[model samples]
Target: MNKETVEVIDRELLTDRDYVSPGLEIIKPDKCFPNMIVEDTSASDWPYLRREIPHNWYVDQRNNYVGFLSRDEANIVYNTALKFRGKRALEIGCWYGWSACHIALAGVELDVIDPLLAKEDIYESVTNSLQCAGVMDLVNLVIGYSPQKVEELAQQLQRKWSFFFIDGSHDAPSPLNDAIICEQLAQTDALILFHDLNSPDVAQGLDYLKQKGWNTMIYQTMQIMGVAWRGNIEPVQHQPDPKVNWNLPEHLPNYSVSNLSADLVKEFLEIVTAIRPYTLLGEARLFSLYSLAKKVCIEDIPGNFVECGSYKGGAAALLAFVIKRYSLRPRLLYACDTFAGMPDPSEVDIYNGIPANLTGFGVGALKAPIAENIKSICKLLNVEDIVVPVKGLFAETLPQYKSEIGNIALLHADGDWYESTMDIFNTLYDSVVPNGLIQVDDYGYWDGCKKALHDFERLRGEQFNLHRIDYTAVWFKKGNFLPN
Candidate 1:
């Protein structure tokens, strides 16, 4: 852990145009910001929010503000800490004091800690938000880096921390450091809330706590943003169920999408409907593609984008849309697949009940290859140049381009057969860069795919915490990008 002062970013890293993480499909707010209670606004614009908070203040704190965290998350924080009244609470990064104010509103006297709070350029807005929220009395400003502040609080506080909110340096180690500190400072029954569930760092921190038997539960008001807690208050058994499906949106759009711009997704969906007609993909998995792609691009993770199974090219098309919309051109999106439908299955796949027709049907032989359609669709979408199609079985073609397809950021394996899935897994799993996302589209529904994932985990000797968005698709994050 970096025990020195928090190294605050000199300027904002994200912009309004930057699709907020976990954003896919956009929902019109029934009531706009400051009033939106339970609705999700993960990958969305902030005009409403801009109007709510003063523009100058928003500009100053926009970089650090968890603008995606709306009222539902605030309520959860307030309620979680409310029970631990009179307890010492910690807000690791008090950006604009939105979350810190909410932490204080929970009725606990919370310490608002942030390295930027020490800057004159930031202190006024941070304090004003708390003051306006009527939480200044309940809040104590601690201007220091997150990791070092934990040590300071550990020595100053009389009792253990009952409520801990970690929303600071998103680097993997920071959350882990905060978690370790919380373990030392927490009462027997404590509640810890972590932001940025999409972030590999926060996710890893939660995993560390879970291994130690913390009652950790992740909640996605819009997208996996708030990870809530229930400590030793109850004697529930430690259930090692790592994969939980984020709640399905109550209404399904005509075409489900990701956290790309609503306008961009709409146009892309129209083109996808024309080309794909039937996208077995769901909203959750689709959104994962957008969020994952955006993170790799935004964080500038060293890798190219690859999709092992681009059937009719719905997913590859969505990726193209995001790449074009975000102006991430020059970075190629390699869409590899057999022009023919499915390649023959191996014994393992056959034993797992994969039929020849679904697993090994040729394009011209009753089942036609859709590579041309994918190309045509991409052409119409003005993203054909970016979609480099390799028309052959994954086993046959992936090996030839092993050198060409260097590091990968998002690997979506949709080949349902065990032979096909594992072939891609063995071939490309190593190429996924740190903080990249590998999403399997058939794990939940296909026994062969599930077996392949299990066998791979066993071979690696490390169990990856798989997260499900639906019955058929599952995703797990890779290594943290935080520097050691």
Candidate 2:
């Protein structure tokens, strides 16, 4: 993964609801768990080894240190791959050496494979980590990609990897190809593991393996990560060993961070600001919106992100940002809007109910972006690749996509009128995945928006886990309790 993709994944993991770490450490050797080496790389010691790496080794930018592997998952990687130490081991990706250091320290004789291995000080930093762990002499840093580099390993190193760690390119064809290449080079009993099993592209790759009759078992999934054993090999899940150390510092539980950093908060706020009235929603609301998107994603909830009234694309941009931040590849943001301004309000949404000063809203008040305008904003934000602009009235456009629609992760209805809001609710509500989210911008402030919400709840005959962010905004999460 490149720096952007890795950072996105890192930030998303930090804000996870289950996360509880000592706030970002001011970088120091003692803070990085200095000399806290793994005593044994045995499968039996996995519970012990996992508690060794710190929550973060957050060094400053001058050294270009970036940590992407989460503490719990890092333990998974170390214990799973390092058990085959002394036999040749292959790692498809090792960005900045967070996980690499631990694996090398376990004496895996690791061969680090990545195209970016020689770029900047990445090579030096990974080596520096190995040197710190005193395993530099046992490892070889390979520079090309796995599929392309697979051919040269036998000629140069003349050793088949008994352990394969596939954390390389997270996209589809690459992961599928990487698995095939590794399978060719591995001994029949090689222990191969893949990271980011929650990712759609990676899942597709896993599906490819199953198609080939490979006996791949998803050994671990607590952190939405998995290990796959190839060539009829069964996956061994680590059962907790009572004799081992299983403590996380009171300040850090499972290596979690309570929240994002100040710099990141400022950046997310600024992005929402740039497209302001396009979104009448404020930072707190937008953050809530973002949190919902991230939560659904982290839970491995199935769906694409959607917005019923995108305006000039502010909220859409926010969703796009979340998807990119988490490296949630292949997630498309459907920014649906009329662009021609709001249609007339229904009798239930008469102008008299809104505030006296804003009664004209029923006459098409918030005229936002045309199709071209939304495109420009998405382009300016560098999210044009995934945030698509859909034009025309919701009643007309939403139905066309219904046949092609998959489940939805988020649905923000800001149509302002009962006819508009309820139209969208009835049409797309069932398309939402279980545990997905829905945000209503005018919930309490506007009677029509409130009316639409109540009607949906009444029809469903169940209440939602609604959270009110402010007087004007409230949101609810769809439960996973599908009735029998």
Candidate 3:
């Protein structure tokens, strides 16, 4: 019998149609085949084959020869396709559904196709994992490869996938068929990802795809394979082309100095400085904070610096300089700004009275292109490292600072209004490592900033000390406060 007919008959004989019995047990490999070779062609980096799959699953090959996925790789793929979640997704060669689980984690309803799942036990394991991951309800597991079955599934679901992943058979013929299925079923803007292009079986398929005019990039270093729609197509390119200018695909994580060299840091800082131009764009208070941060950055501060109100990133440019100078380990200067000016004044009272500056002060309108600016700075510094530019209001965007919050040695607040200052101070204060300095721009220049600082002092009492050094106001954490 053919593979499809044999799978169906085998499944039917094991149990009643309604009471689907488990499929045949697979003999798990003693060592994952993907990791046998460390060459560029090896699945050495197929995060799933290396880190994420558990030993229990590996030992019980009867659960299907499905592999696991690393948390890092899972997050990367989820983030990369974040904009398309909640829409339809298709995963071919789903193994035990690890990648499908991740897609569902991003809030997408996914169709996971696998012939191995025809085995009752393997199917049960996959379904159990999906339910455990809170995605069983969103996932529709398909057993056979009938194009008609796939079409019917798509029609019954009344949805089309915006994202498609081919992870099934790496054999040339299987991947080629899977790609054809994805092309036929995907919506116009659908982005397709193919795994194991480095595999011998899929090499020809990848080359065929390139000839077909698909835009492809090999994440060889990470050993994750992916492909996307060429140029721009329908439903896929629908949303305002996401902020590709910054190129911080969630798939890519931020880099710290510990992993970078001095030359790299200096080169990147120069690029940031070019775009943010501390001297050219920032206000007097920001200028001073920039100067001070640069000085301390040159010293032994063991962490990253933050600019909560980096309108155009002038202060960030200064921090970038310091990041390069020290070659500090594990610290990256994070420049946060609402590329589009500020949030509406209606949401916060800070901008209620001040006249709008070069850019509308209280509106969520962009004064300058944030991504382009940072890119320019990167180019000037000749640093390959990317400066993460988060776009959103302080309240909405600060939450992402969680990773570096506890290690922040310096914080420059340039919101210039009471609500803005209060938000950052209250929310991020506890996260500041001991002895860190909180610098406030416009503390003396604007009524709103001063009022907020006073309120903070009243609340904290002796917890911290506030000092005025020229145009800027600085807060030194008590007890741990040390001098440079």
Candidate 4:
């Protein structure tokens, strides 16, 4: 027990007052800065966490409740829970119940604590919000402060949290108390999420936790939200092992007439023949390939999911849908892209002709709002917990992430340009486990993307082989690529 805990046990009321401040006067808001309420727009543009805040919603010094949780934040919570389905969870300071709702929707049982909700009116609103989102039944709400109420509930329920979120009070002692109690209740593989870690009060709490051996990963920007996972700290040794349906040929489309539903076959042929304005594969092929890749991987490999070059997140969106439909285990999916647009062509050694897609950056050919639309679909489908969006180019960002694909069964490379394609292939290829499959989007379509693939093969001599598909090519690595 620490000083505060000791003080509490010694019959003295430990002051939550220390968590509050008054003497220092800061500039008061003339008009509400509603932006503060939603997931701070300035928050790192990691696609999974990037969410839009309403203009009217602002953070009030006293009782701030304007901007609702951004769609992205809500989606993050949803997907995390989905990935940890059947795992126990605790969420401290669940305001408005958006994160809690996402957790429940992801099929995880939850115990949510919010002392502020002891007020009946707030309780009613919380219930209303959860009900509105159709997740009221998933939560076991504990209405009181931590240690006291949380401890009592833990004693009664005898539940241990595998995942915890500290989003309640962004103050010192309050969050510190939340962290202390959470530490006592977390399981070995537990993950703790802290909101507003950049704030002075919360930073103190985060600092204290870090001192106690918690590994913190900071997602900093407007308002820092730090995630600390409590577990055996070991260097991750990921080996990607993407697989194919040994029976499924690489070059052949999965859209064979025999396997398709009558309706689907008709729609596909119509689209392929250009009888319809859209090609199902042209319009939805990217995502469908993503879906197909994830399905093939999950069915064969034993690891999490990831996709590079996620324009409109179509591929990732398909991955989430498949994970949900199959009741797959370990439901997390990561999607990486330059949400603003593609990287500068000049910077890319290959793919010079690739037009800019949306952001006036890359080869401007792909649509801009597709990724946003994928997010919207994620919310609607209630699979937010299964998908995580990393916003940025593959070269600038993905190389840093510690992947869990020690058994990567499938990899989808859709950069469609040589530089981007080769970058991802070079960076992530070795991570693929044995017998893994790497699917390239523009293997046959783009000159640069194709050239990069061939060059990589020629330079390496025996890294992978081309499985010529009808419209695209699938490369299966017999062995891993040594990093340059």
Candidate 5:
């Protein structure tokens, strides 16, 4: 770990003690500014921060400016600037200069561009905040919109920027455009940070950088923040607050199994609970697989149930159980996998164009035990006779058993990579009976899985009317649903 000392100004000197805003308090700085030591740790590991905002700078602004930056976010901006002190920096949007104040205070030569800064009130407020912070000389306030104004500044200054803070429009194409334009004016080892990554639009901008080979990490701030940079320098990591609800809600309003009997729901819960040790699927996803499998069996859909990527056969056990409990006709559940581990991911298997291996989807990942373990799971579920463990890669086993696997009722696709997912669809899609169900487990989580589904749809010249099973899963009925 490397340590650097940063000089901090007493916050009491920066804010007017008499200034007050409605529904807000103007509190004095708790302590005097001291030279603080910040640890510069290895980029690969999460950085340990003794204090988030060592300076504890606070500004009392009007209600409109209050929500722009939380205390923690303000500290992040200040510390980031401190790390890159003496380097040129650009900020795309500065509502009332809250963040700009922090950046300038860290000794960075800052340029702030925003159309709102053209308005008299906003411009005055920004300048006032900067002047009060004692860093007015560090900032060059530009009154114009980005991309256009950013391009003009790039040409005029003819200087490569080392740090960027993009908090522009949260709309699609706008964020993406800002990133592309700023990238051109950035140094080879520049660090570009973006705010509002919770918005899918803002995330697209970061995705563009990741595709361009920049190292990236997302900070779980209130609105979420993302950082992208080239070369060896790693940005300091922010630990997420435990009090915040970080994970997406599993039970969405759209998820409904009202049609299912209370008894059936109870039975599913029992079965899934029993097999929970063998699967990585959450409760929502497990129920989705169970309900869909039960649907095909109850409706007497012609064909057997097929599961690709049956990791540990937990889900396959559920499929066989549904056939045993619901299907009036005899149907087999074909559980397929290598019984070894995942094959090597192709180039197309990536997360927003970042290589799969870098994101934890590498060769031999998500490996299941040998085929005997799957058989043991089936025997424990009392579906041993109905569940058949087919041990091999999908590319080989799928075609080899295509004859015996004639006419599928439901195809549960859990293969996470591009090639694995595509191989299952290519070989088994034709065997599915009309209106049969195809459930995809990683549609939202893996770019490669989504691409395979899309490419297959285009090849068949038919767009599927996909139904959301959860945040990461979706299913569509074959030959019955189409895009509007």
Candidate 6:
């Protein structure tokens, strides 16, 4: 029972490299609880309580327990270990040894490296949990940080690992750094799993593995998990929960304002300066409108530009300016609105259990200035010829001018109320040509507006892959013209 001599021998056996003073502490469980039987009830408590248990396991009470891995995520770890049973495994960042216990239970020889294990409390908890699970003897706990510690293990072991579970630092270079080092030490056909792919920075590590010729796939666990391997091994497939909103996982093409030409930037600045006093739209939203206008013209989308709720004629003015400067052929800008104020919000315009009228919206709430003022602004911009102001309710004017409006290349639906917003889509959504853009200005600010868009989606039997323009505005193309 010589403690220091046993530590030196364990270090030498686990890692052949020279042990630096105050270096990694290798703890080998002595099988003190040899007769202990981890009851099935143990799975119904602490870190495993809230996790989804296997159907065969009986539980007395199901309570909530918060931990790193969800039930599905833990299954992934256990299944991966089973695939490589009897092989050497390495895990970085083992919090309370939940994932470590899962790995050990699969008959895999595991080495878990984590900096927090140096603390006495964390060490006791991890060992106690592992011992309770009847797998403490299968895991060699290493106390140190990753990348550097991983490098030392690589040098000392001088052997490739069959499986790697990297749940290390989620910061940018930290995850990426661990992936780089792990890939070097991994066998040619090894499987490498990474947790927390929901973090953009952590996802970069998985991205690197793909770049290096590993077959990669992502599982939509609570925090998201990704696996990369080089061989024919197919990891178990876990479908994402239908209840969770897995925000767009794949890349989509978007219009970047930074790519705008210097001349276009200057033109946009001039338009914003001219219309700043007439509209309530922020610079980001106005710029989006300006960009979309240019896009339709450049692509020859073959229709007019229309604004449904032209509050004070600012956004309409910007669209008119874009057409005047960029369009190769003649195209008109239709400013459709009441020109008096917003119409009365109906019962359907309820938001968060409150009527829209109670939340600063009612008849005459967003009234525009006198018609003469809109006309004066149009004249000042020299866009009066193309900017046609159709003053009336969208319900009335849109149908009245259906033949005149014809096919629309772009639609800016700014109507704040649910009814008014739906009116714009109901009357004109079909008129928008394929690949055209429909920008909703209040989709995020007004819940009613959001509901209207969702209702429209249900009516169309398809969802619009909306792209955010700002905090309150979003836009989508008329059809699926680009990959999501």
Summarize candidate 6's per-residue lDDT along 16-89 as a digit string, tens digits.
21111111122333232232222343443332131232212211122212244544566567656755655789
The lDDT per prediction is 0.60, 0.61, 0.52, 0.53, 0.71, 0.71
Which digits, one per residue and each the tens of the lDDT, describe model 3 over residues 1-484? 0111111121123212111101111111112222211122132333334232121212233322433433323333453344354567787766656566666655567787778889886687777766655557878898977445567777887657778777777655776666766677767666776665445455445555655666654432122455556423211111111111212223323211012233433443344335434333222233345445555555656556777776655556656655665644656666776676665442223322444342244456446576666555645664326356767677877876665445777787777667778877787766666666677766644566777777876787643444433223443442442222
Instruction: Please list the residue runs of candidate 5 whose C-alpha ends up more than 4 Å from where it truly belongs after superposition.
Output: 1-260
lDDT of 4 by residue, 1-484 (tens): 0111110111011132111011011111112222234224443433322233122222322345333333223333443444354567888887656567656655467888887677876577667755654556667888877767778888998867887778876655887888888888888777777666545566556666677887755542223355666653111111111121112212222211112233433333332232111111232233245335545645655555667777665456555655666634665667777766555554233322444343233454454454445576566556677777776678767677635433445577777667888887788767766666677766654566777887877776764544332234344544644333
lDDT of 4 at 134: 51
TM-score of 1: 0.45
TM-score of 3: 0.42
Higher-ranked by lDDT: 3 or 4: 4
After TM-score superposition, the amount by which residue 483's alpha carbon in candidate 4 deviates from its true location, in angstroms, is 28
Candidate 4 vs candidate 6, lDDT winner: 6
Tens digits of lDDT, candidate 2, 1-484: 1111111122233423222221111111222333333222232222212324233323324332222555445555654543454467888888766666656644557888888887967787777766655567877888887687876876676768777777788777888888787777878666677766555565555566566656555522222354555542333333222222333323121322112444555566467656654565554467667777777767767788888887777788878877877644468888888876777666666432444235655465566755556776677678888887788788898888865667887888877777778888888999987778888887655567778888987888866655545335667777833233
Candidate 6 lDDT score at position 64: 18
**Candidate 3: 10-residue stretch with minimal lDDT:** 17-26
Winner on lDDT between 1 and 4 is: 1
Top of the candidates by TM-score: 6
User: Which ten-residue region of model 2 has the weakest summed lDDT?
Assistant: 1-10
TM-score of 5: 0.49
Number of the candidate with higher lDDT, 1 or 2? 2
